[model samples]
Target: MKLRPGGFSADRVLRKFLPRSLLGRSLLIVLVPLVLLQGVALLLFYGNHLNELSRRLAGGVAGEAGFMIDEIDRAPDMRSLIIQETDRYFQFTTVFLPNQVLRHLPPPDAPGPVDDDLARALGQEMHRPFNVAWNTAPDFIRINVQMVDGVLSIDVPRKRLYIGTFYLFLIWLIGTAGLLFGISALFLRTQVRGITRLATAAEAFGMGRDPGPIKPEGAIEVRRAATAFNRMQERLRRFLAQRTIMLAGVSHDLRTPLTRLRLSLAMLPEVEPGEMAEMTGDIAEMEQLIATYLSFARGEGSEQAVPTDVAMLLEDVAAAARRAGATIEIGAPEGLTATLRPEAMRRVLTNLIDNARRHAAHVWLSAAIHGRTLRVSIEDDGPGIPTSQRETVFRPFEAASPGGTGLGLAIARDIVGAHGGDIFLFDRPGGGLRVVIELPA
Candidate 1:
C-alpha cells in the first residue's frame, strides 16, 4: 500500500503484519489486538470462575464430611443416612469403616484400603473404602474413610483442578483468536475500499487513460491525495496548452517567410538552370520541413471530434496513395463507425502511408477491430527499422530516412496520444516495417 502525500494511511500500518495487501494488512492490525484482548478477557473470566468453583468444591467436601460425622454420632443406626446423604450431596461419594468390620450393607465386594492419610489424621484403624474419581483424570484415584470410633476421613482427588483450569484457558484462547481474526478481516475490507479505488485510479492514469478526475470523497488522507492529483492534472493541461501556443506561433512565423521565398524562387527559375534547380530543391525541402512543424503544432484540441466512418477515411487515404502510383491495399468494408477527429486521423494515416510508399515497393493499409479498440496498420515490404531506431523515429527531428523530415511520425504519435490512443512502429514478420494505430471503439 502506498501512503498519500499529505497524510499516512491505515493500510501502511496494516502492511507490517500482513505485508501483502491493504485489506490483509489492515485486518491483521485490527485482528492481533482484538485477539489479545479477547484472550485476556477469557483468561480473567475462566480464572475467576475456576477459582470460585475450586473454593466451593473444597468447602462442600469439608462440610459434608463434618455432617456425616455428626449424623453417625446422633444415631447408631444412622450410618445409612450418612451414606445416602453423601451420595446425594457430593459429586464423588464412598464409604469406609474399620477393617473388615465395615461392609457394604446392601451387598459384598472385596474390601478396599481406606485412605491412609485420612485414617492417620482421624486416629482410626484401617478400614475398607471404595474409590471415587471426579474432577481428576479417569485414571486418578481417591478414597473416603470412616474410623470405627466415628471419626470420618476423606481424600480429595488431586491434580483435577489444575488440569481443568489449564485446559479451559487453552480452549478459550483458540476460540477467541479465531473469532477475532474473522471479524477483523470483514471490518478491515470496508476500511480499505477507498484506498483500493485510489490505487486503481493512479494505475489507470499512469497507463495513459484519461480516467477523468477522482471523486475526492473518503478518509482525509485519500481525499487529500485525490485533490492533489486533480491539481497536478490541471497543471499538466496548462503546460500542454502553453506548449501548443508557443509551437503554433513559431510555425506561423517560420512558414510565412518560407512561403514568400518559395514564391520568389519560382519566379527566378530557368535562369541559372542547374544552380537554380539545386537551390530550389533545398528551399523546397526547407518548406516541407516548415510544413511538417506546422502540422505538429496543430495539436488534437484544434480538431473537433465526432462519430466518423473510419473505413471511409481509410479508403480515401488508400485511393490517394494509389493515384500516386503507390500499390496500397485498403482493408475493411465501408461504414465502420468510431469516435475520432476525422481530419486529424486522416492526416496521421496519410503520413504513415506516404512514408511507407517512399520506402517500399508495396504497402498495405488495413483496419480491423481489436477487442474494444479499432486498429489501423500500415505495413511495407522494405528494409525495416532497427530496434534502436523504432522509438527514435517517433521523436521530433529524428528522421528515419535520409531525405525524410522526421516530424511526420512524431506528429502522428502526438495526435494519437491526444485522442487517448496509441501508435507503435515495429518490424513486420518476415521483414519490412509495420505501424499500428490503436484507438478506442
Candidate 2:
C-alpha cells in the first residue's frame, strides 16, 4: 500500500506503542489484530445476544409484577394473597405501599446495556408509569409502579435478569484469546531469531571477522534471505582470495626482472656517471612503487583482532616519526583500549604519519573515544590538499605530491574499510591537512 504524506512521522508516532526488535514487532503483528477482533466480538455479543436475553428475563419479571398489580386492583382485600402467590411462583418480594405515595423515583445514572434493555422491556409491559432501579441493592432490581392511592414496589433478584451463558461465553473468549496470544508470541520469537542471526553474521563479515557457516532456519522467506546472504559472503571471500593471489604473482614476476636490471647497472664501471645515476634513480622509484602496490594488495594478512591500547599505538607512531627526523606531538588518554587488528592499525597510522612528515615539519597524532567509536587523527602544519582533490587522493595511483606512489591514502582507506571504519581528510583550521580515522570500539 502507498503511504500518505507524513508517513515517516506517523511511523515514528506508532513506534511509541510498537516495539523496536523483530521478535516484539512480529508478536505485535499477530496480537494487535487478534485483540481488536476479540474486542469487536465482545461488543457484538453484548450488544446483540446478551442484550436480547436480558430483555427477555426483564420482561418475564415485569409480567409477573403486572399480574400481581392487576389482582391487587381487582380486589384490594386480596393483596396479601397476590403477594404470597408471587413470592411462591416468581421468588420476588412484593411490598404494597397503601398510605405512602412515592413522589419521584430517579433514573439510573450509569446505565449499562442490560439496564437499558431491562428498562425498555419494563416500560412496554407496564401501562402505568414506573421507575426501575437496577442494582439499587447488590442482589436485587427494584421496580416502583405508580398507583392512585400508593406505589407497588417489586424487588426481583438480580440473578433472574442475568444470562449465565453470556458471562460463560465471555470467560471462554478471554481465556482462549490469552492462550492463543501466548502461543503466537512463542512462535514469533522463534521465527524472528533466524533474522537476528542473519544480521549478526552479516555485520561480522562486514567488519572482516569470521562468522562461521550460517545454518538457515525459520519460515521459508527468512530461510531464503539467509541463503542469499551466505552465497554473497562466500563469493566475496573467493574474489578477495583470487585478487590477492594474482597481485602477489604479478609483483613477484616484476621484481625478478627489476632485480636483474639493478645488478647489471651496478656492475657497469663508470659508463657515464650522470646517465648511470639517472637510470638508477628511475629504477629505485620503480621498486618503491612496486613495494607500495604489494603492500596495498596483501592487506594485513590473516591477522586476528585483539584488544589493543589506541593511545599506546599513537605514541608508538609518534616515536617512529620522531626517529625519522619529523617533529611530532601525541595527545591521548591513558589506557584507552579497543578491539582492533593491531598490525593493520599500525600500518594505517604509519602511512598517515609518514605522509604528514613528508609535507609538514610538525605533525600531531591524537586519539579519543566517542560513544561506541574511537577516533584517531593525524594533523600536519603543511600545505593542505584542496577540497576538490581530497576524494581523488584516496584513489590508487592518484598522488597529490611529487615522488609519492599515491597508494598511501588508498591503502589506509582499504584497511580502515575492512575493519568497518572510515578515514576522512579535512582542512585543518590553521592551513594544514587533518586525516581523521574512526573505528567501532
Candidate 3:
C-alpha cells in the first residue's frame, strides 16, 4: 500500500476554523473589511446630509432674527409695544428694561435666557449669533442680539439635529453588524461543505477502497484538489490491474508444468516407492501453492450486483466442512440478505473456514447486525497468533505452518476489500484467533 502524506486534507484544514474552521476565518477576514467600508460610507453620507441641513437652518434663523431686529428699531421708545409684538411671532419672548441695579439670576430651569453677555450685546446695538445652553436640559438657545438704539434679544432652540443623528447612526451600526454576520456565515458554510467531501473521499481511497471519482465542484482551489485525487485514483487502479495480470500469467505457466510432473510421478517404478512418495508430496505442496497464488490474483469477477441470502450461504459452507470431518458451528439471523457477487463471497468464506479448521481443533461461525453494517466472525479454539504478528500474518507468504501457503488470508482480504469491507485478525477474548469481517448493509 502507498504511504499517506503527513498533513491533513484541505477540508480538514477548513473544518478546524469554520464551524470553527479555516473557511470561517477567511469569511471573517472578508467581512471585517466590508464592515469598515460601510462605516466609512455612513460617516461620509451623514456628514454631507447634515452639512446641507445646517446651512438651511442657519439661513432661516438669521432671516427670522433680522425681521425681529427691524421691528424693534422702529419702536425704540416703546418698550411695551416691542415686547407685545415679539410675543406674537416667538414662542418664548422676554424683555428686561435697562436697570442700574443688577438682579440676582433665577434658577436653571427658567425658559428665558439669563446670559449677561447677550444682555450687554443687546444694549450696545450689536447683531451676532451666540449659543447659550440650559443647565437643566440638552436644549441650547441661539441668541441673535440686536442693539438698534434699544436692547432686543431673540432666542431659537438648537441641538435637535445632532440628537436625531446620534439615534440614526446607532440603528445603522446595529443593522450593519447583523448583515456582516449573516453573509459571513453563508459564505463559510458553502466553502466548508466542499472541503468536507474531498476529505472523506481521500480517506476512503487511502484505505485501499475504490471510492468513486471525486466530482470537481466548489472554489477553484477545491476543484484543483479533486482533480488531483481523481488522477491518483486512476493511477492506483492501473497499478493493481497490472500486478494482477502479471501474477495470473505466472501462476498459470508454473502450474501447467507441475501438473505434467505430478502425472509423470505416478508412472515411476514401484521399486522406488520411498522416493516416489517423497516426490509426490513435494509436487502436491507446490501445486497447492500455485493454486493459492492464482486465487489471490483473480479478484472478484465483474458481476452485476444482486441480492443473496447470507444465512443460506453460511449454512452450505458449514455443512460442507462438517462432511469433511471438521468441527464447525454456524450462527446467522433468519432472512439476512446482502448485495454482492454470490460466488465470490462463497469462495472467500470457504477459504477462511477451511484455513481455520486446519489450524484449530474447532471453529465457531457467527453473524450479527451492527447498525448499518453486517459483522461476521470466525473464531478458533487453538492458540492464536502472537499480538505483534497479527498484521504480518495476513500478508502473503507469511504462514505459521511450513507447508502452508499464506495466500489464503491475502485472497480473503482482497475479496472482502473489493466489496467495500475488511477482514482483521484479533485476539479472541476467551482464547485463540478471531477473524472478524465487516460489510455494509
Best by TM-score: 2
Better of 2 and 3 by lDDT: 2
User: What's each prediction's TM-score?
Assistant: 0.54, 0.83, 0.55
Better of 2 and 3 by TM-score: 2
Which candidate number has the best lDDT? 2
Worst 10 residues of 2 by lDDT: 103-112
Task: Give the clashing pairs for model 3.
Answer: 17-20, 17-21, 17-22, 18-21, 18-22, 125-147
| Clash tally for model 2 | 0
Give the TM-score ranking, best first.
Answer: 2, 3, 1
Model 2: residues with Cα > 4 Å off, grouped in runs: 1-25, 96-112, 127-129, 146-152, 224-286
Per-residue accuracy of model 3 over 54-80 as CA lDDT, tens digit each? 545445444555566666667666756
Candidate 1 vs. true structure, TM-score: 0.54
- After superposition on all CA atoms, what RMSD does each candidate show versus the true structure? 11.0, 3.9, 10.7
RMSD of 2: 3.9
Error of 1 at 128 (Å): 12
lDDT agreement with native, every candidate: 0.69, 0.85, 0.70
